[model samples]
Target: MSEASIKRAALYRMVTPEHICPFGLKSRDLLRREGYAVEDHRLRSRAETDAFMAEQQVKTTPQTFIAGERVGGYDDLRRHFGKPVPDPKATSYQPVVAVFGMALAMALAGSWASLGDVLTLRTAEWFVAFSMCILALLKLQDLESFSNMFLGYDLLAQRWVRYAYLYPFGEGLAGVLMAAGALTWISAPVAACIGTIGAISVINAVYVERRALKCACVGGGSKVPLGFVSLTENVMMVAMAGWMAFRTWA
Candidate 1:
């Protein structure tokens, strides 16, 4: 074939209707990336395509032609070439676990009878109870999003936007509870109960997620692996609950 003929005879696949995206740019970028361009019109008539394939001793459907050689469809070629596999999701598990840890530590502190006058059970109580409550409230937003997912809707279409607002809310309440609990021993039990409930919620969420169910903890920058965070939170709740029970009975 003449160089001019070869230059104009570019390889292209007729785009099936399914090949389009929601934005209607079906595989254009992908085709461009694969050393081919999308033509607005089919390059060859069906009979001509079949004739070419018969002459080349190749199958006709979605074939590739390069330098007088039938290269086959790029998909099949890629399979032969072995494409790199990408990670399914960018797993994350930081802030959620940290919150649970902080709450549990505070709960543990409340159970320490020998903490002395500077910091008494009352102080621990307020911090634990209030912090846990704040966590529950913050998590409720995630729960709302998760529930919506079952109906084919995505919660928090963008990442970390929700957290920008919620982090302050959590910190504010946590600060108040920490201050109040530190001043009075009476607030300690309440804090422990709050913490216990929060932790249990985390655990339950994780369980549901593990069962291929919806997730309700998709909060700010929370794209990480949440199953572990959920488990840890649940254990922390149990620990806090046990500590509160022990203190109450003692």
Candidate 2:
């Protein structure tokens, strides 16, 4: 679009003594990014802000007008530009990604510090252990929420609701024991039982039932989808348990 034909946007945002409205700034930036010439209007006080809103017959500040037409707020501007707006209620894999990323980093750091190597069998073990610990921490943050989500797929949790509540603690304990390379007898059994039950649950939910659902792997509040990642977690635990048991016997 030519400069003359480019849309002109008017923005009114609060710049009061106590606070500067962040959305107002965002609106102005968004307008500029969309090739709009922004006419920035700052309301310096609560009273002034209120007056502008009242005069405009709008409920919120950071109001935008483009080419003499009211274009609503920041979210509206995004929609106008055909950009995907973030939804607060939406499910996402961000929590699981962050936890797993951190676990991998910690595993590498620990391996380098102790064994002077980052790629070794011990590093793999530490990675799984740390992942378990981190995942457990997330679930323990809101056990009730975790249990609710977990019961949707976990056979044991569905049959015995208390298992859902105890799941985090069990995972945490097993992780710690495995990390310490101590009490393999206890940790091995615990890991095996939970992993077996979890794999069965995931297989049934994702394949047999063909139910699309959110994963409780990160926590109850997460939007992480249930599927391959959940299955992998169970498989990892099962493998770890078997490894520990073999080491014990050897």
Candidate 3:
């Protein structure tokens, strides 16, 4: 296509000897994907970048201009094209949903492989066990961070801080034992102990106190809110423990 037929955008970004702005590359890629020819302008030093920002009255770099109209920074450029911009502080269940979805898939696959069936009582048990394992794995990734987050809402963790750290290992162990349908004597008590504490904590924090907080059930890094989903995790654990005990003894 000719120059006149092409959509054109001018992007100004910081590209110093020490650093290159990542968002600038993102902006350039977006423009090209949207069929725009980008005029890439590098503010080679901090002085030049500051001057540009001052002139544009903008706070950040990776600014884009289209049709002689300044579209601000990378996020602003996305908005200019009517694209949805991601919010950092947005409450999202995507991570939790993904973990649960994967756990369910694993359960179904395991059932088919072992029993030649996708749906069964064992599959449901395995699904919950797998979910616990995954969730515990997420927590164990950064135990310190998870503990810190858990201490915010957990009653037992607040009183005895070490419980927060040990919680992941206990949950993971319970999950493994439950999945194998072995040593329910050990797994049942572990699951029940943690699950009761977790459920009560969630209810107190989210239901009774009505305080909105991040859930440590998935991980400290997760933005999953402290609410029904969080409660469900604990409830599932408690229910799993009871079911295992009943199956083994009654």
Candidate 4:
């Protein structure tokens, strides 16, 4: 086993029915109601848990610590316990702009494609599979966030990863729809779906900005402030959406 394995080894599952995150205590209570004994704070900290593992002789690989510091396992748990880490909400705004810009660029790409020779039926099918694939990849990176993206309200603040996954697939599908629209004038359905997705992205972006929360678009691009570049990108997406609508009907 690699050293990184030991860093977080066995930590993810250390929580017992009783020891659940306070944020998820309702579930713990429900589990108790269902008759499983749970601890409220069975595994308090990484040091505590690591000590338990060592005592139990749980074999784990060493961890490669660049800083040679033991970042507490159960960061999720810590966050739930209200320990202060960098506020995800305080991330740089630049990432927010970059993410939106990517979305807008995708929208334009799809609009331009709609004017191309791709078949509408083929494009729609493509859009579905392709978008789902992107979603899948995003989910692969972080399933909890993806779950929250579709269902909303992740208590863990996993939204940033979800946003990253949704952006590319959402925009890519929009572009594919545009291509199909030009060929068969039947890509409207796909365009509509893409538009709906775009609207959602816009909503997320607006909400982040309105809340004055920094963008958590970590995997999507560089960490920076939301700025003019982002605004320009969104304008392009608007253009793409408009172009798709026109070409699909025209």
Candidate 5:
């Protein structure tokens, strides 16, 4: 379409001495970006803002109207522009990603500081240990939530609820021992038992039963999905345990 035929938008927002609506500015900018000629209607006082809302039957300021039709508020403008609106209640892998990313970074830093190399056997061990510590910390943050989520798939936890609560402590203890390269007898067995149980539980829930669920790996509060990442964590623990046990015995 030609520039002359571009859509027109009307915006009503608060611009009082004490407050200026940020959404109003964003709406105006978005409208301009989308090739809309905006008619900015500023309400200079609370009374005027209230009056405008009442007249327009809107509960909020920063209302936008496009092509003589009410386009609602800032969120509405985004929808009209075909933007992806964020859902506050939605599940995401961000928490798990962030935790794992940080764990890897810490591992690299520790490796550089101790061994003068970024990639080594020690580095890989540190990565696994650090990841365990971090994941355990997340679970410990809200033990109740973690236990509840864990019980959904963990066979041991389902049979013995206390196991869910004790799991984090066990993970954290094993991680700390492994990270320091101390108490191999204790840490190795702890890691192996938990890892084996976790792997089995996850396989049953995800593959055998085909049950879809949330992961408690990051934390009870996280929305991370139960799948490959969770399985990888268990596998890492099992591998670490095996490595540590072999080193101790050999």
Candidate 6:
């Protein structure tokens, strides 16, 4: 579009000495990036902001208006521009995929550097250990949230509430020990116990009962759908635990 025929958008945001509305600035930037000439209007005081809000009949600031029509907030502006907006209620396996993908990539890179081969037993072992550690980290980020979410479907957690809180620590400890190829007696048992419980819970919740739910494998606030991916995680842990123990014995 030419300058003379350019589209225009008005963005009203709060910019006071003490506070600035982040959404307002984002909306203005979005409009400009989308080829709209933005008319920036800063409400410099609480009184002015309140009056503007009252006039606009809006409870929030950083409101956008395009083509002389109100386009709401930053998310609303995104929608108006045909941009994708994240839905909090939606189910997705993006986090799980990301954790597992990064773990595998890191494992492969390490194997190539240390053993001169990416496709090796060490790589497989490291991938599972890395995945466990990363997943544990995510859960440990919000222990309360993870525990609450885990209680929803985990039979062990449902029966013994304290297990939910300890699960992440156990997973992390086992992963570290396994990665170091040490203390197989302790790490292997911990991994096996947790893995067995997790596998059984996943099977009961997603397969036998056929209930659709979010997986707590990633974290409590995660949108990862509970199903085959979750099942695989538990099963991998169980298999890895057995393999590590066998390798140590042999």
lDDT of each: 0.45, 0.89, 0.94, 0.41, 0.92, 0.91
lDDT at 46 for candidate 4?
Answer: 61
Give the per-residue lDDT digits (tens) of candidate 3, residues 1-250: 7867988999999999998999999999999999998899999999999999999898899899999998888888788789999899998889889989999999999999999999999899999999999999999999989998999999999999999999999999999999999999999999999999999999999989999899998898878899888899999999999999999999
Candidate 5 worst ten-residue window by lDDT: 219-228
Off by over 4 Å in 5: 1-74, 87-91
lDDT of 2: 0.89
* Per-model root-mean-square deviation over C-alphas: 13.7, 3.7, 2.7, 14.9, 4.6, 2.0
**Using alpha carbons, what is the TM-score of model 3?**
0.86
Using TM-score as the measure, which candidate wins?
Answer: 6
- Could you give candidate 6's per-residue lDDT for residues 1-250 as a string of tens digits? 6777988888999999999988888888888889888889999999999999999999888889887889899899899989999887988778987999999999999899999999999999999999999999999999999998899899999999999999999999999999889999999999999999999999999889988888888988978878787788889889999999999998
Candidate 5, residues 28-143, lDDT tens digits: the string is 99999988889999999999999998998989989998778899999988998899887866888888788789989999999999899999888888889999999999999999
Candidate 1 ranges beyond 4 A from true positions: 1-89, 97-131, 141-143, 146-221
Q: Which residue pairs clash in candidate 3?
A: none
> Per-candidate TM vs. native?
0.32, 0.79, 0.86, 0.30, 0.74, 0.91
Ranking by TM-score: 6, 3, 2, 5, 1, 4
Off by over 4 Å in 4: 1-90, 93-144, 149-171, 177-188, 194-239
- For candidate 1, the per-residue lDDT at 91 reads 61
Q: Provide the lDDT at 223 for model 1.
A: 54
The superposed Cα distance between candidate 5 and the true structure at residue 178, in angstroms, equals 1.4
Total clashes for model 3: 0
Regions of model 3 farther than 4 Å from truth? 13-21, 40-59
